[model samples]
Target: MKLVVQVKLLPTPVQAAALAMTLRACNAAAEYTSRVAYERNVKSRNELQKLCYREIKERFGLSAQPAVRVVKKVVDAYTALHSGIRAGTLGGERSRRRVKAESKPIAFRASAAQPFDDRCLSWRHDASTVSIWTVAGRLKDIRFAGSADQLATLRAHRRGESDLLFRDGMWFLIATCEVPEPEVFEPTDWIGVDRGIVNLATTSDVDNFQGRRLRRHRRWHARKRAELQAKQTKSANRLLKKRARKEARHATCVNHRIANDIVAVAQRTGRGIALEELRGIRDRVRLHRHQRATQSSWPFHQLERHIAYKARRVGVPVLLVDARYTSQTCPRCKHTARSNRPTRDTFSCRRCGLAGPADVVAAVNIRDRARRAWALVNVPVSMAA
Candidate 1:
């Protein structure tokens, strides 16, 4: 399994400058590669394109760490759409919603093209430390924030390393670690989660596992965003950039905390988690001033992805089931009857007079649906009846 561990690097002033250059180059390379790959897909086979990219990289000094990853994604998207058309997973033109719209401005960082040691298979650690390449040999003090084993794993990605630079004052040596998949088992505790606008998330099964909403704080950001849109001055733009970075960092930290807390609760309680398979939420969200405040405000999908991976580390499995009727259906009466969830905060059941906080009910039902889907999938049952 591809396990990622981000290690912090504190480089000297010179090293930081070099790193910034590398990051900018990497981002540029990634953008170029993406366009080239998309165009190449029409004229050549995948195998040929790989060889072409390798040759291009060797010819041009564009070896940013993120280039390969980004191009791979672009190629995959292109291929998937084409293949889907041929196989009929979708018909006609690709959906506008499926296209990846970058929430933040597109800029390449030098550390974007960090290479991995292992190919398709093999223990990544034994491949040797290939992630770091020092020019003007023997650099500054950079420490690993993990165990020896973790460091060994990080080396798996950097079989042969390159230096990168960014525009900002920073440098990075991208590294990767391969974590062997742990033996996964069915869990006894079945947990349900409800991800929403009012509150970020709430669990049906875990009493204490509730995710707080970012709406109030996010509203504070909305006003800042408004002032930002009015002026085109460089200073104003720079302030907007600063504010955006701060808000993004804040959102990420909140996601990390919420995800870790959810998994920790599951691990302690010996339960499995179930979350809705939300699709097109970005487009489906109502077009309003508040929703328009930030396109990336909804972090439900990101949090779920994090939770699934982290949960796997400790053998806590997660199930993504159909979200249809999960909110409106009555959990207690098993009623499929529709009811209007007029407000975000309230939850009232029409069939059963089951009145409680709306989030709580939805959370429990989400858990219930998870158990059902798990059974249908024929995966080992994780929930205890």
Candidate 2:
């Protein structure tokens, strides 16, 4: 499995200035290359590199590798844009968002991250320092810090390019690491997880990860953001961006904790994990005008991703079961109807009178579905035929 380890860099003032200049120069070169590609209708990385390599080196004062990286960056941006269009993620052909996206060449932010290959960057793990190529010159002995496990992973499995990014007045390098996944063990049972807006997550085992505290936290931030917007000052605008990042970090921390707990239990009980397939959930469900913001802002996908990656690391298998009627179907009587869930949280079967929390019932259904699905998957081919 491929994972990224982020380490914070502590650069001297002189080194920082050089890094800032290098980032700006690279992005400026990328913008120029993008314009040329747009004008010439060229998207091939090699062909575009041939056209812009000299200009990037001479005009932007970049070295050989940095120049090549800039051209590749421009080509990648166009590739991603085209991919989004093809995937219909940007919208339909005639949609305003799609039209706007296609009307202009891609643009890079001034502080956008830049990729550095081995030729342009080298890590000294033992000394906790790095040597990197900058426009000013090669910077040596720039210190970096990370957690013990992160550093170990970097030393053992780090490979490919690292991205240099500046954010929130700090610098970070995100390095890719290819870790070997353990062989998956045969499961004794399964743990089903039901995701929701109010509860965040509920397992078939009746463990609840509530969203009440997070909801309050977001509401407070929203009120503060409204107050800051009303001020209409530069400082307020800056603070708003800072607050948004802070809120995102808090949500991510909460998700990490939940995923860790769930995966730990699954491993301890010799069970696999089952989750509902929720692709395009926003499109499948309708929302009221007042509920749109809350629904859209919740990080349902992130929680699922965390669970999957953590499960993968420990050799626990994960299954995505069908999501339809999980909440409405009665787990005991097998009766299926909207009336089974009279309220958001309560589930009651009219036929057999089975009652419980709606989220737990849904999770139980998911677990049952996984057990049947896994059986069919593992069946021998010549059993009957």
Candidate 3:
């Protein structure tokens, strides 16, 4: 029922400067606020604690919201320490107060404009007000939502709450939104997914969610990464930062396209999507050098999250089947034998003498699980075994 629809934002140069200034203020405020907490917990300081925010405001000249965020973090740390004590998890006889050279906590500011403003990404509310500003029209495109409805909806879902930060160029908020379990569905078909490093994804619904060719963008990615890293001059660094933002934008766009296509496939199939409950395929595949390298490049988690959310939006369900033995178990013979999976990419059942592509075998098993689950779940309407 609740979900987030994030769109890109476009900002002008002036706005970008303002955003940069805001990030600086937040960073400085974080350093100030955290230092205060570190000092206070080292020893009691009732006087200094009272005026911390005022001092930060006067010194850093940050917006009230960003200042408040810093204050919250400082207070949160002490509260955590206190709770740890009562729970007998913290001891007072701690090591010498070796001060950590405090770096500003990652921070970003939001200068949300009015809803109609084309230059801003705005969200306004009775509960919480938020707006997004962008840099020069060329970069840092953000959305600013400024509507009473927007604010009310934002508050309705807590996971969508975010702590804004400016890192790796453009602004970011660690945000989340809930994927509601669907209440209505056709309940006849099921979408099956096969995850891989090269292809990113491949669902059993005719269209491959992602093709299985190992798209080792290593050279391309490394080239960009190197350009980003090899910044010797100030101007060079600035340019690299800008390029990084562009790269991220490009990647996000591609991901969106892929995710949207997946949702479309499910809708066309007239049922829910089913994926193996692979708890940690990475762990299983991480030992080998090639697999490890491939694993690092694959964004499996992001794809699944996108699928879950996209399914929720379309009023479709996403089913996760227990993946244990799904690869080795023969879809035709129902035999659980290691020989059933002769190779990483091939599945064969020794008992029934069945062999096929490993992923297809896995997809069939997952597809069956989904069909059975759907049939059992909607027994009132579906013909169940």
> Which tens-of-lDDT digit does each residue in 264-322 have in candidate 3?
87787677788877666656643767556556655567777877877786777788987
Q: Taking the tens digit of each residue's C-alpha lDDT, what string does model 2 give over 62-108?
A: 99999998988888889999999999998999999999988888999
Evaluate model 3: give its lDDT.
0.59
Pairs that clash in candidate 2:
none
TM-score of each: 0.67, 0.95, 0.64
Q: What is the C-alpha lDDT of each candidate?
A: 0.60, 0.95, 0.59
Angstrom error at residue 111, model 2: 1.1
Cα error, residue 151 of model 2, in Å, equals 1.4
lDDT of model number 2: 0.95
Candidate 1 lDDT over 1-385, as tens digits, reads 6665444455657765554554454455555655555544442445535644674466445443333544554455556655765665544345443333212223334455433222311222443222333323233344324467556566554333222322233433344445666777778858888876656778885354333446667778879878887987888888888888887788788777878888988989888988888877657656777556454565667888888888988888888877777777778887765463556566677776776677777888888887877776775466542
Regarding TM-score, does 2 or 3 come out ahead? 2
Q: Residue 213 CA error for candidate 2 (Å)?
A: 0.8
Considering summed lDDT, which 10 consecutive residues are worst modelled in model 1? 115-124
Runs off by more than 4 Å, candidate 3: 1-15, 42-49, 62-66, 73-186, 210-214, 222-255, 283-286, 353-355, 373-385
